[model samples]
Target: MLDAPSSSPRLALVSEDPLARGALARALSDQAEAWTVVAAGTQEELEAARGEPPDVVLWDTGLRLEEGAAPDLGAPVLALVADEAAGELALGAGARGLLFRDVAPGMLGAALHAVARGLTVFEPGLSHVRAAPRSTAPSGAPGPDTLTPREREVLGLLAEGLSNKAIADRLAISEHTAKFHVNAVLAKLGVQRRTEAVVRAARMGLVTL
Candidate 1:
């Protein structure tokens, strides 16, 4: 569940670029009233967030997702990405929101508000780049390329960042059924993780955000 927006909502900005970090801080500060914007250039600084975690963490996509990493702050993460592919990867890696670095003031403010409400946001008109064709059997059967209509529906919801419970509720199916469908989708996509499945489905044009 999302936290309620208090009188003063804290926002955390994480970026390595000095100019970009400073500019983003100022922009967010002016984005809304009583917004406590905190800027951090390093992971250590972000880890040391005072009181409860910030309402949201806006990070630059240039910072690679380190292996075995966990969420540093207990807030929804909004990533600054360069393009569609990067945005998809950020989503796959569990960033709740995506915005281009050259975003306008209105869009930045809107993205922050949307992400704070526990909604996933991606840059408009972003689509996946075509991936290499998957190897098929000698008989030319569709190997992992064919998903049932129901599985396709589940895939789309997964791309939207819905949990099993939410997907079940949205699809009018039991939670166990939702889990089964999700596992089936992952297996058919030849991926081990939910994010990888979403990325592969996007590459295949099976779903869009």
Candidate 2:
């Protein structure tokens, strides 16, 4: 266990395999900024070590949902699964987010932050999994189904936490054009921030994280 400043959001990494848990913790620690990696172990050990609930719990489910049950970690849980079936199972088990085991460290960090803030996250691979029905879009706002193909592409990049320049490079378009598409996606989703748009898109089954 490592001590982190109280101001930094605390993340608990839970996995059944010690080797896998250590590797994930190290990766997360390497990219940590807004949050800190606190402990890696079972939920009970994490709670006992900190003597308080973490802001978020990143549970690495490996190839299966252990014992076919999601633990109540006394905090939001972001599940790291191996495949879409396990991802769906984790969601059904009440996990706030479902990411694949091969997720990049940066994307995993973003999902942890999002889930900690009470937003649901899904891996792009799980886009085919239909999410539960959500409330209709805001009045005068275009639904997710109405986003243009390019705008939808921008939305997916946003879900990956890409900046305007990064998106431009990825799409081989002008930065200004990428910015324009980002704004369009935000407006259509009726959200002001990239994270919000990602959340809305995921809930609408338009895009995943």
Candidate 3:
């Protein structure tokens, strides 16, 4: 289960551009007295925030998710992107919603509240991108895409920077089993490397970042 939010939700903001980061922080101050904003202008701060997990992570174009990481944060994150493609990347990283820089300040609070509830929030007139094509194939089709839920769970953990031993401990499995699942994920994606598997899976929308 996800962690419960404190009396007031904690907010974390990450932006490569300090001006943009500060602007967002100031705009969010009107949200709630319980809300606290933690500012991060680099990947280092982003990682640090993830360790303690903020209630919300407002991401601008500056942040990128590295390999061996699936977004498994305790707090929800809303991504700010410059365009549609950037939004897709944020979605792959488990962002709860995508917004452009021009969004009205009033919407930020509502968006944050919506995302905290696990729904995707966006501007009313923005276009929605479809990720997958409809398929008529049976449930057990003959291909690597038919991974079981357990396999998907393992794959997600692998993408989240967990070593084999670490994943084993988290899942209560043997290291060998965790390693086996990682290999399976690689083979399913038809990639020989962990990095490639993550990229391929995320692009295909088979696995979230």
Candidate 4:
């Protein structure tokens, strides 16, 4: 992968479907002046590659949103979803921007740049799918103070889509210990899965996707 210059915002293109990922990469190929596709792969592959995180992650959520599906790539995410429900789920999962899968190449480029600049972008038609209100925590959710400092660190790692072994390496702890901390974070966040915990934390303002 080519390293993007500071003047060129780096982008990571992620999609579970290889064909979709290839098509998007091709679409981005001509936009080198605006941004660079520094990485392209499934989330797991990207995580395993361990490259520098991109400025924005363009994730294609095909056809529908899967249960507990979320992209936590340690950068702002611009999700390409199929419909309103998928768009809403993307926002709830901490995606900073959303667009329909059939977005024009030009519009897609604009959305990527907007998201990289810390602006939320959404297809005008899907404007109704907004982030959850920050004023109120999810019902029955614990306060932010519930997580210990170490657990908070683990939570941050989880948001980055790190595996337990990767988290252990980063924190200099045993994999078993990392797993323990991960479980603790999920429990404290009142979530049964890592994706759910990340979504809950983002909604709660505990972590900025």
lDDT of each: 0.69, 0.75, 0.64, 0.80
Tens digits of per-residue lDDT for model 4, 1-209: 23334687888998879999989988877664666788888866786786887889999988856433345667899999999888877776678899999998888888888887788887998887865422222467588887777888989999999999999899886564587678778877777999999999999888989
Estimate TM-scores for all models: 0.52, 0.55, 0.53, 0.61
Pairing residues by index, what is the TM-score of model 1? 0.52
User: lDDT (0-100) at residue 201 of candidate 4?
Assistant: 95
What overall lDDT, based on C-alpha atoms, would model 1 receive against the true structure?
Answer: 0.69
Backbone clash tally for model 2?
A: 0
Cα shift from native, residue 104, model 2 (Å): 0.4
> lDDT tens digits, residues 1-209, model 2?
12333587887788778899889877876875765666678644664465467798899887655223454557899988888777777776568888889899988888887888888888888767643332233567567667776788888888889999999899886564576678767877888988898998888888765
Ranking by TM-score: 4, 2, 3, 1
Candidate 2: which pairs clash? Answer: none
Candidate 2 — which residues are off by over 4 angstroms? 1-6, 32-34, 43-50, 130-209
- Local lDDT at 94 for model 3: 61
lDDT of 4: 0.80
lDDT tens digits, residue span 30-122, model 3: 554446764456544566456677667777664332222223446777877666666665666467787787677777777876787777786
Stretches off by above 4 angstroms in model 3 are 1-6, 30-34, 48-50, 62-73, 131-209
> What global local distance difference test value does model 3 have?
0.64
